[model samples]
Target: MMKYLWLGLIFSMAAFRVMAFPAQGGCKLAQQHQITGKVGRAIHNAAQAHVVVRANMLEASLSNAVQAGVLSYQQGHKQWLEVHSVRQQALAYKQGITSHELKQFDHKLDRVTLYLCRH
Candidate 1:
């Protein structure tokens, strides 16, 4: 009877361990998914920061252009507003945006950059 009770106790302990630990594959997959999510979020944040900083720098350049008479105040203000809009959009989206949309914003900035640098 004692031997049977001891055997049952050991069996129950083993069962408890199996239930607690779970299968390694499932656990590892969950961990991997979590890591992927974190990495994606980090990349997205970095992209937003990069775009916003670029917009700010471009705005500064526009200010300098206006002051130097390379561009008129009217034109500069318009472009400045555009840059602000782009920066705001970059800050707004939580998920990754399409490259086409990014290209459109970059192309607008590039147009201004080229005009400012050339003249």
Candidate 2:
């Protein structure tokens, strides 16, 4: 009985930590909402709102990088360089680009674009 009790307590604590994990998994559901919601509907508006909210999320990740001196100006420049290169490549491949690949490329460019706009 005591062994089972101890195991239960350990499991509870582990479960708590697992549940506290960050929101990477959250994005899939959010994206689903964005896709299915009507263009001018309230859920659609909320989906759009998520975009702005997610942008600030970078503050936490980027601040940590900056504080650790990991996100140098050169790194930012490199990001911009990659964005340009990807954009040109994406355009050249426009005819063959699948929606999934295009969306992924756009996501990368969007991140760099936001970083550039803010800095």
Each model's backbone clash number: 0, 0
For residues 1-119, what per-residue lDDT tens digits would candidate 1 score against the true structure? 99999999888766644443122222232331222112244237545555665676667767766765557899889878888888787667777546676666666656655555554
Q: Model 2, 1-119: lDDT tens per residue? A: 99999999888766644433133432243442233222232223333333323333333334433444445757644664565565445444423445575456547645654453343
lDDT values, one for every candidate: 0.60, 0.45
Error of 1 at 15 (Å): 82
Which residue pairs in model 2 clash with each other?
none
Error of 1 at 6 (Å): 99
Candidate 2 Cα lDDT to native: 0.45
- Every model's TM-score: 0.55, 0.32
Q: Cα RMSD to native, each candidate?
A: 24.5, 12.2
TM-score of 1: 0.55
Sliding window of 10 residues with minimal summed lDDT for model 2 = 35-44
Clashing pairs in 1: none
Write down the TM-score for model 2.
0.32
